[model samples]
Target chain A: MVDALSAVFQRPNFLAFVIIFLWGFYIMVTRYNLVKKLVGMYLVQTSVIFFLVSISAKKGATAPILLSTTDPVHAINYVNPLPHVLTLTAIVVGVATLGVGLALCSAIYRRYGSLDEEEILKRLE
Target chain B: MSRHFPAILFLLPLFAAISMPVVCLRHRHWSRPISLAVLSSMVVLSILNLNSIITHGEVRYAFSGWSAPLGIEWVADGLASMILVTLSFLGLLALVFAGPTSPKDLGGRIVHYYTLILLLISALTGIVFAGDLFNLFVFLEVAAIASYALIGVAGGRALFAAFRYLVLGTLGASLYLLGVSYFYAASGTLNMADMAEKLPHLLNSKAVVGGLLFMFIGLGIKMALVPFHAWLPDAYTYAPESISPILASLVTKVALVGWVRIIFWVLGAKVIVNDIPVLLLVGILGTLAAVIGAVLALNQRDIKAMFAYGGISHIGIILIGVSQGNQTGFVGGVFYLLNDAVMQAALFFLAGMAICQYGARTVEDVGRIGKQAPWFTGVLIIVAMGMIGLPPTGGFFGKWYIILGALEANNYIAVAAVLLSTLLTLAYFVRLFEAIFRQTPLPSDRLPSDIPFAYKLSLGATSAAVIMLGVFSDPIVQLLLNHALPPGL
Candidate 1:
């Protein structure tokens, strides 16, 4: 139990993943403001990206870039490049999602003049 | 050229959608024709691909000649090929009906309208055929973004509805990606077939189960399965008339197909049925969705909202077949999905037409205009009977197969739910029919006169196809059975 506790404490990324994900979930479920909900979604997305990127980390690894001097590359000395590549694509999609989401929220605000969920519901009714 | 059918099927629409604005600048009248041409070519390509696949086995096209497992691949397996053909074909019919119906409502933004639609169709095609998890996510986002823009394009309460849908859909996609991250972390691969091969060795891992759960919930939201279906009704109700039929017919089905692909193909059915309790949960959810969807639909004032709830109920029936996880159940599930697309498209198309013609929005508001358009009303009754699973309609064969599958699995709960929901479906649709045919005829000036030739052609084709599918379901059932399970299941 002590060893497991130390292992968990040593990995801050894992803790960050849990905290940020739950925080975003709380915000999304509790906040009724439209823009805030979008922000909460982004927070959740960021947490996932961070978790994915962190998975590639190693204790003593450098970047996966090649050099003339490092022709015989040691696998243990290089971090995985695939997750970073995936995260890049994910980040691009995340930006697109935020842009469209914010546009929709703005459109809603223009018509209803409020971003609160209760207010919007009353107006819709 | 024939070998390039899969790539061109999506790339053509994507390129055309990008150039649609420039085309609009050159000639505004060109948008509709451009969309029609794109959809027509898509239909042809999908049909050709399906035929080739049926004859020559699965068609695997690797991107840029990198080959499978190392680079992106597009696999037109039996399931993917059949659904792609059906989706594009239904999309073409909806496009035909859409053009004459909602030009005034869309203002001058019809170019953007067609652009979003083409993008959506392209994304859906990509999703159906995508062989990698990351590729699926990208295509799913493309579809979601296009739908978000399309839903709110008219700028009214639709904006609010679209916003709500975007929030839910984004979170769902995010959760799914997180699940994909776990899968990737566990197996070190993103190719679905490769993952499936590796997953069984790691079946007992926490990451695999967690990943599957996240994906299931994410896709459940996208498929609008019962509890997560809050955004469907308003979004369908408020969308422009031209857009509703296509969205109603194709979107949720594609999402469900994606979910099934992941569960059966990526995770493998052995894990789902033997190693986990997921099938039981799915069965329970299906039963609940069946009863709840029908009951809620009965209380809906708006015709579109009622159908939206009814769509939920049908989804439940499809789920019953899926949860059975056997050959018979798989056949029923797959067949029901195809039948629902036709039945729902015809119903929505007819509703759009009736609304446009009579200026009616609610169930009660629809007067006895059926007398004015007898042929259209006849098609409506035929499609409605199909939804209620009446004999000699496509819907009956689908439900019958599912019931048989449920019995085989000894899932009496799902069987009871399916039977009860059929009765509920009958109750609501009968109410709609009575409203349509029994109401007093309005003044002569209120009657609709100019039923477009395109509307008549598309609606007639779908209605006739529904009947024909019911009568000649044996061949289709054979086709579904032959390819019901992925290899090694």
Candidate 2:
């Protein structure tokens, strides 16, 4: 348990990811402005992407690209390419989601003439 | 050509969705027929694919000639093909039912609407066929974006509802992706079958458990299971008339299929049910949703809101079946999934027609519908009866099978909850019936006889199906669902 705790502390990157995710979630839950809520959502998405990317990183590893000069590429010498590829796909999905979200927000704004979530709900009620 | 069935099934609607606007610009009247042609072709392909799966064993198609486990593959075993056929057929019927617009004021947006509808269908098809987790996420986003635009196209409170749905739906998708990342990190593969192979070995790993939890919560929100169901009522109520029926029938149902695949296939039921409390938790949540959804629905004035809440209640029943984790329970759950798709689509189509015919939005307005449009009201009564689980409706058998499964599992609470929700369901739908048949008259719009014939035919077809499905359920149960499900449930 102590070793696990020390390991977690040593890897602050993982801790930061968790904190950022929670913070984004908090904003999404509490914020009344639609734009802010969407921003929170984006933060949450990016944090997950970062966490996934971090899992593929090995200390002192080079980029996934092979160097012919270094002949005979070793697995340990380069970062794993799979997570990068996966996250790249995820990033594109995230951006598409964000674009759609912003478009929806703009539509909401045009209709209600305001972007406050609670205010809109109150009016709807 | 047969080998390319999966690609043809998904790509047809996709290319059609893309070209809809251009087709509309050239000849406006051609857009709807073009969409119908694409969807009809997809239905034919999916049916052929399902037939192949049944006659043979599983049908597996790898994209770009890539091999399995390493390359993405679309495999229709038992379950996936069943859903593929149901979703595509429902989509085709709903598009047909949408009929031609008046071509007056609403003419401009008709092309866009059909485009989004076609895109949504394409996304749903892809979601069901995707063998890789990341591929599922991509399709999920595509579906989400299309639905958002579809909802907002109605242009009023629908915009707000779509926005709210977007926020929650995006959050759900992100959580699901994050969960996939954990699995990928642990198993070094995103293909579902590969993940399943690795999952048993990693049962004790915290990352695996965390991933499961994240996915469960994410999918629950997406499916609008209790406590995460706030957005569904409005989204369903406020969406464009033509779009609601398709979304009602297919969207959440496919999402549930995704959930089942992840829990029972990818993660393994033994790990999910034995190693954790997910089964019990879902069962309890389902019970809560069942009761709460029915009670909330009882108070709703808007017809669509009532159906949306009722949808939540039925989802709970499906959860109970899954929690049982026995063959009978899986069968019951899968059967209920099929029944709900047909019945709910029927109900929503009736609701849309009522709104178009008389601008009927509430129960009071609906009361007048019966006196004016007897044919529409008659068909609606059958759907309502089905919703309330009356005999000779497909719904009754689904509940019957579920009750038997619950009894077999010795989960009396689930059994009791199922029965109680039935009563609650009857209570609410009966109120609608009373308003339709018994209530005093009120002034309402009476649509002219010029109302499109296609709308009535669609409603008639689905209503007839509800009864036929109940009577001829044995063949379907033996053929489609029994084989469709993964073995050893």
Candidate 3:
């Protein structure tokens, strides 16, 4: 168990991803405020994005720039660019979701005058 | 031009959606005509595409001349084209229902509504045709975002419902993306066919197993398979009248299609069924969803909410069929998917009409509806019988096949669940019909108003299609579904 913990801690980014993801999930489930829930959602998304980006990283690697001098066969010299590209798309999706979430929050506040989930449910009733 | 049909199947609506706001700026009346024209053409193209697939084989098109495992690919196999036909046809009908009524109901926001409708349809098409996991994720998000706006367009309790849906939906999508990432880590490929080819060797890899688990949970939430169904009832109930039919019939079905693709096509049946017991888990949960949904549906006074709960039960039945992991089960699941789409759309349309004509809000409020609109009430009775899985309607055949599949798989528990849910469905519909035919309408109830020609056309066509599907189930399965079955199945 100690060895496993040390090994997991060695990969700090993965540890960070796990911790942040759990934190976000915890907030999302436990928070009463809708905005806080939205924030938690954002954090959860960010952690996933971080994990994706971290998976692309390699030691002693540079950016994925192919030139005439670079050997295509030894691809480990450069980080995998695909995950970066995917994370870019994921980030855009995350932002779009955040914008919609915030808009809904404001709309909910306008009608119910509160962003607390319980209060809003009471108003709806 | 014909060769480009796969690309144009989705791009047409997407381009039209992008140009809609600008086009509607001056000639607002043109929006309906343009939307109808585009959707009609889509229905034609989808039919033609299905024909071509039937004649030749699966059509594959890589964007900008880039092939698989390198760039994005779009595939229109037998199953994809069939779903495309269903979505585009239903989308056309929805736009028709929304045309005359929306301008009155939505006021100035009608243009935005049309745009989002087209966008949603386009994204759904993209999902059906997607050959890569990342592309599927993007399209899923596009469809989801469009639905969020569409649901919240009514702006009251609807906004809150949309918010709830948005939160849950985004979480689901993110989990899906995470799953894709894990798959990518394991296989180093995002193309589904390539991943499928590669995944067998890595079946025992922790990353692959984790990915499958995440993907199933994510899609389970998206498809609202009972435990994750908290977001569905309110969202479907509070959506604008015209939008509810489309949401009811298509959105969750499309999500289920995604789930089916990943599970059956990418992961393969042997792994899910024999190796890991994922299918067993799905089967058990599906049985749970079927019973729970029916019980919840029986208690709902609101008609749309009741139908929404019933939809969950139907989805559960479809999942139960698919999870049985046999040829008969696969075909039954696929057939139920198609049949339920038509039945649910018809139910919602009839409910909308009742709301429009008699101001009926609850099931009880629709009392004596048969006295007012005899023809529609007749259609409603047929549809209700279909929902109860009676013979001569499509729903009966779907349930019949699923029960047969369960028996074939020796899953007596699933067979019992199907039978029990059918009885529960009968109970609810019997109650609804009693309210419709037996009770007297309140004196303050408004006189029945004439439904629009569009409503009559769409509803009639859908109900007719339901009966036709039952009558023609054999040919459909033989011609399309058998060919669409995955190799192992």
Candidate 4:
């Protein structure tokens, strides 16, 4: 049982990535409302955050960090922490995207008095 | 001291962009000057770092002093530096042009406009210098989000265009993130160099190939290549005259750098380009886009929209050379990317100024305002010719090299499309010019009598630059060839 669980956990990132990509696709294509689409974008980007973080997670290892002489991964105790650091960059990006996306949504709402794609399209036409 | 500077290459713009708004609050008129000052200073800094980049080969600046596979790093070598300068300079010039275009038209919103543009510039700069898969995505998000806001300001139909862009843009970003996840899981590392090392061993993995497909599709959407380009025309057509030129010139070009970087550096060009399915897919999409973009461009009525389609066509042409996957061919493609943006922006910016001056949105709307706007008309004519790839223009060199590269490859289809697009380009631009420049004076000429010298100076500089870049294509191409795209790959 433990072995099966370890094997599954080893590839846990695949699960996180699939869920995120599919969620993003659903929101992008199916949603007609503008702000909802931005929400979907946030969901999608957060999924990427999950994937990047999962890349650093190990079955039995702590984060790839060295706190003291007692720490194990001093040689090989912890999991890879590189991706965790990289995800800091990703999180920053995600926040910026969300901020800009919401800002544009507000601007759109102000201009058209609606965020419906059909309503916007009617005006454009 | 110098070794550390390259690492902070991306961090500089990142800081400048984050601070532009803060600065604007203290002094509202300060955004453009500060953004330009920061960007120009960066150009000088990059130039100073060239030798370190070229001699030592790829330099990696790891954050927190940790090595790749353990920490985030910024990689700025020759290619990244060159791309940085190109993006920053164009960004600065666009900011300069935007500065003098009276903000009174937009009421009090100029602050919002300049501030967001500075942020966009920073994001574009960071993406060029990112050394890891995750950093690339992060910076791309910053750039894309800012660009979406830049596109639809003061709303109206601009909102429609921005919505279309947001839908497609989000899809592209997610696809890229998905690809990054696959690369991470497969290699267990997100650093570009580490991935390059692990890539050969995982060449046959279905997950890896799927990742490549997702990434290319995503970048393709951002670059507005062929099938993914439906959002671009509307976005460009509806964006304010002030923002149109920047979008026309820089947005797709930066995404192209990200596309090339991921494909070449992370995937390792030799493997990705040679892999049968990937090659075939790229070639097919590229060929179709090449033929279709030009043919479809002929039908556009809006001046900006037509140029947007034309820009898409040039993008397709650049790929024709790129898909060949040879040094000569790829170099032509990259150089063309630079030249294409410059010429396309020169033409588009002038048209934008005309639109602002005459309150005209479409070609037919401008009718005989040529007489009312003679000086603007003359500059527009030079730009229009350059757009058509006429001789003594930068546009011509991009076409010349692509054709030469195709001929070297003995690829007849590419050669045919190159020639065909030029003819189609000329056909459209000539008629548009005649309509705009034909001497039909209006009875009630109420257009602005004089556009500020700053506007004229910016346009004239770019127009002259089109011809100068063409005439000096030899040196520019050589410099780019020497610097951009690693020596062998």
TM-score of each: 0.96, 0.96, 0.97, 0.89
Best by lDDT, which number? Answer: 3
How do the residues A1-125 of candidate 3 rate in per-residue lDDT, one tens digit apiece? 99999999899998999999899988999999999999999999999899999988899988877755665557878899999999999999899989988988888888889999999898889
lDDT of 1 by residue, B1-489 (tens): 667788888798889989998878878889889889889988888889878877787878998998888899998888998898889889899889887876866766778888899999999999998999989888988898899899889888788888889889988888889899988989999999898889888877778888888888888898899999999999988888888888988999899889888878887664653455676778788888888999999999888888889898888888888878678888888888999999889988887887886777787775466667786678878998899988898799999999999999888988999999999999998888788778887575466577789888889989998998899888888887775467654
Between the candidate structures 2 and 4, which one is better when assessed by DockQ?
2
TM-score of chain A of each: 0.92, 0.92, 0.93, 0.80
> Could you tell me which residue pairs clash in candidate 1?
none
Candidate 4 stretches greater than 4 Å from native:
A1-20, A53-57, A63-77, A83-92, B1-12, B46-60, B102-105, B272-280, B437-439, B487-489
DockQ of each: 0.84, 0.79, 0.85, 0.51
Candidate 4: CAPRI quality band: medium
Ranking of predictions according to DockQ: 3, 1, 2, 4
| Overall local distance difference test of candidate 4 | 0.75
Give the higher-lDDT candidate: 2 or 4: 2
Winner of 2 and 3 under DockQ: 3
Q: Please tell me how candidate 1 rates in CAPRI terms.
A: high
Per-residue lDDT, model 1, residue B451, is: 79
Residue B199 error, candidate 4, Å: 1.1
- For all candidates, the clash counts are 0, 2, 0, 1
lDDT of 3 by residue, B389-474 (tens): 88898888888888888999999999999889999999988888888778776666557476789988888888898899899988
- All models: lDDT? 0.86, 0.84, 0.87, 0.75
